[model samples]
Target chain A: MEFSKPIKISRRHVLKMGVMGSAALSLGIFRSQLVKSKTGSAAGSVAAQKTEQIGFMYDQQKCVACRVCQAACKATNNWEEGTEWRRVLTSDKSKAYLSISCNHCEKPACVEVCPVGAYTKREKDGIVIHDAEKCIGCKYCMYACPYHAPQFSDDTGRISKCHFCYERQDNGEDPACVANCPTNALTYGKLAELREAQGGVDQLEGLPNPELTKPSWVIIPKKE
Target chain B: MHWHWMIIIYLFLGGLGAGAYLTSFAAEKGWLGRNSSLRRTGYFIAAPIVAIGTVLLVFDLGQGLTKPWLLIGLLANLSSVMTWGVYILAAFIIVGLLKGYFTLTNKSAPNILTLSGAVLALATGTYTGLLLAVIKAVPFWATWIMPVLFVASALSTGLSLTALLAPLVEKKSFCEGREGRAHILLIVVELIIVAAFVGIMISGVNGPVAKESVALVISGVYALVFWGYFIGLGLLFPLVVYIYRYQRSKVPVIQYVSESPSATSDLAANEQKGHHSYLTIVSDISVIIGGFALRALVILAAIPVWDGITIL
Candidate 1:
């Protein structure tokens, strides 16, 4: 009732707030987040059963970055010129390559951010998929994805990312990128088996920690 | 990057429109003032402003609409911010139009209806913040403080907008009252909260990305606009103007030594009051400008930290 009255600024209030802010900043709160960045990066969502969960294994030692997987993905998914869901992101001077897509993580950030529920992670196989019709092309998924996985098409105004070739997987075939790898660098299998084959490791020097979204992939570091 | 000028405009407009409803509710319920004109003016302005914001958001996301689904049958993504926004915006428009019509027809509405509208308005104000805050990968945006900051600014914008418009629309009862003081207070609150929001973000979670984003706005390419326009012109300038007006209003006038309580003296005093009331216009406009600049600059300066292709 008395809100119309003049507001008096309190010194004690200001001091308390100032102290709190200083403590938060001086404690290196931001830097602490970096140390905790990899906290849960090694594990998948616990609620989701690990049994028969679809996953991938990328043996960087065997990869040659031939551009064949890139071609195969474009041909299969029919991505336009200057668009390839499967990309060979390589280092300077042709050092090595890291191919990534919708990690199809157990906890997919893209699915959570899609306003219209356009992006979904399949319950059965744990494959993340994008629905063109449902999508408003908001591109929230682009920012939501750390991998830069979703590609926006100017023609359709919709984002299309790798669904990990769910259609092929449903037919008991490897995803295009895995199937067309020249040196047998890419492989697909059940999550448990892939992790066993990968020696149960998730961290790699160049790759982001899987704990962020618990990506269902196994990457074997190229032997130095 | 997707949160561009269009999104910023939408944010400003949405807050403006929703905030009007809140002010109206306060006026209608005798919170800010028992001025019925404040309520009527609020109802009148609410629908049209919100419509513009909602339309801009639709077009921005729809990519200028070749597809039919762009305008209709929005999904109820419970986890998504936009989903809540869609529903809230729709409710605000309906409530606003209905209230506007009721006020136009000179009919008093039930308290329940007005209260519901106010609640919807609050949601509308907060939803835009949540929309950005839910972006998990963008450390620059993923913060709980975002919604609080947005709501504060929205309320400030709403109060200022009401003060700004009351003079033009219903000058007799509303503009020359306690709303100016309230507007001044709200902007000051907004300024403090904005600083806190930045501090929280600067000290928030996520590694290099959040740090870079804070840096980007404070001292990076966005420094000029953020500091100069938003803080200087929008917050500080408006603050100075409004505080000066408030202080000036508090000091009793000498009546210009008329030595007689005549019609002309009364007229002179009224004329002075009118000019003082007009001062609200400057401060309100400053607040609105500051609000828009803040939203737009935040979006413009946001640098999404991409997970690097770190070659080892």
Candidate 2:
């Protein structure tokens, strides 16, 4: 068989191919930057529109170890026996009192690990909400929550947690626990404002590190 | 949070089923001289063992039996390890059952199906460990070694179980051959992995809670279950029996092959080397018990890094 003559390329053809490759690479880089900026701006706008996070503040110096907040929370949620959403933790070392409920953390592990999507962190106020209807009673959230906030109910076979008293807050009323605190040790407001204005710490001697979940809570540590 | 014995059983059985299927697959591939009995025994047991374990898992769920409809929601979150587990388990169980059926009917399972089943079996075995390892709350469980240890234990126990049952099913001994060697190797590897797993946690690299968990297993609350059941009975006892018997089996091979042996001696020799010998039975049983004890100890000894502010 006869072989075809060898193909030849001039300097112009080589230069044309190189130029075209460079142009294509530059366009690809430019397109990616454009897409990234568009998405970034969209995220920024969404972040700006999000409502301020509501947080709970506890003054350990003022608390008298009263179990009334726990009772009020039970009254508010009407939880069954053996279930307490708010707990009064006392430290024998410092003689301090800590009344803790759900911190409604920024990176809620319960929200991330629930196989059934039963837990959700609210966009409006950053309140971590538990939807009982959607719960599969797997108790995964119970293990996932660092705060031990999600309480399991044997009756309903579902989990419940502090919802920041969102219904009462919507109605411009304090949560039952905060409303009923005789010492006014428990308070609630915008998390950022509370942190700035109060200048208190997010963690105390007995609390889990705030970095785990960035809990929407501020505490006035007890004086030694 | 405490998981009941059902979870422990489920973890134990899941690994066993996967391990058995693997052993059977190896036998089918000519590991045991093309013994259809070994293959059939493994195939028959794998799927049903896993299925029973799965049923216990479902019933253990808070709403599993009362509100069975909620189980469909297990697939809702793809990022959740439990959701991935559901998928892996479902596929493994289906393939296992189909393989078992094919073996029973004396039909050849497709190579693709067989290969997929093997992959799924390994996944199922690994997934059992990964399930606990992902829980960062328990520092003792959240280790890279968790899955590796569980896989080794699964293979060891699964092979022991197949060895225990093969003679009854096939009326012959497979315990004196390469199967014995493989079983011993698996047990040795499992012992090393267990040591590493416990050593890593107790050495304080994982933190105080992890150390506390290890203490609970090694010398504290679950010490008996860990030391007596898992270490002595599950691992060491079986290791001793297999080693002794395997050596004996090797020494007598020449005598058994010679025609000079008397008929009475021949019966005694056959009985000694039989798969259903009292030593083999006891060793296999010990391995099986140890497997259960290991799972139980793992589940019971996990001390969470924190149990919330209320407990503190």
Candidate 3:
């Protein structure tokens, strides 16, 4: 009868119990915040938003190597001479006229490599913007961009690239390059709408041989 | 004068400084327990140098204000060497400070923290080479051994600087003992590594890019600096001095905690305190200067010359 009962708690037992209790409390708080924040943000955004298409489509065959778009971009951005944000590249394969510019990628390499967090992606419109003041001119982003979108200005030692004319877009105006294109090769619209209206890459004619860099450019091949 | 060039230089300098500091720190705390003062000085100087180097990089970016956050927010990108480099540099700065404090206080830093910091420093130091090497666009920089070469260069430069400064920081007598021996050993390793690195670069003559890079380094615009500074003065001169001293039947007399004060005083009194020979000082300075030149040249030479060449 005297040896009937014993109660014992070790340090390890106490520590384990404490850890589990704290973890449970943290998990509960985290779960509640996650649910609450998700719905509130979603509801606020859904009320006034209009779906608009804003993306680029290039017709390689139609490009005449005039580089009007490149000139228009420089004028719009006020870029220094000899520093073209958009460039025209010619290779041996087919007398190809390709305008190399920022693709505004879904998974942008520049954003990933920027050491100074100067680049941001817009959630609503998928526009990638760079703040020059935040740039460290490390050129890491320059190397990361597959399209060679980011251009480093030797004068300022910062990366400069196409901003997609956010000022014009906000005012409901098209980007200068799109406005100035004579051949209508560079078209900007909502990505979803553009995807729906255009034929797939296969439907387009006179396209160059596909390379591995899966450029986001929606190309419409011209009939030969 | 491309901004990319500046960034690359910054990376090289930061990595070299961080690597040297970490290696010296390890040598100080490890079983060698020699040249603690020299190691301490190396770590202290490296932290500031790295900080400045990073600042130069950011300033060159033209958005220095946002640069810090960029480094902090996107600190993890395992696929990119540049991302890893940022984290490594950050860790090195923090750990280098703590380790310096511990050394001064005669306290032991947490084992985990020290080891992790060292590993990070090593990775950061070596990754600079990997960054260049991985860029297939620059055929000269695309070798696997580039990283090792970078690490070796960093070590040599950092140690040489440490040896040069130790006498100035502490009593000349303090540097004369076991610490000097460790410095000698490190110099030996550095020379061997430098030789191997140079050999590899030369052997790549079959590849035009590699051949061009080597030519740029050896007989081109940078030939004099490369040969006169890095090879003859930085590496060879130091090696010869180390060998001569090692052979002269003079082992450095280190101070031990167990030695009696009277005995230590007597030894100190009897010992003829020697200045780091003028040649050693010259060699050290030459190596540091040469190291910087080598890094700058590597960055410039690694870029493909044909990148922007247009055919008529």
Which candidate has the top score in lDDT?
2
| Count of backbone clashes, every candidate in sequence | 2, 0, 11
What is the fnat of candidate 2? 0.45
- Per-residue CA lDDT of candidate 2, range A9-40, in tens? 32344366558745644553464356447646
* Residue B286, model 1, lDDT: 78
Query: Is candidate 1 or 2 superior in TM-score?
Result: 2
> Per-residue CA lDDT of candidate 1, range B80-153, in tens?
67767876887788767767766776667666767788888999989978888877677777778788888888
Pairs in clash, predicted candidate 1: A40-A211, A41-A211
* lDDT at A116, model 3: 43
Local lDDT at A216 for model 1: 87
Q: Give, for candidate 2 chain B, the lowest lDDT window spanning 10 residues.
A: B259-268
lDDT tens digits by residue: candidate 3, A84-179: 777776645556556656667666656655644567665556677777765656676654553556777767767788878878987989988888
Candidate 1: CAPRI quality band: incorrect
| Deviation in Å, model 3, residue B236 alpha carbon | 2.8
Better of 1 and 2 by DockQ: 1
Strongest candidate by TM-score: 2
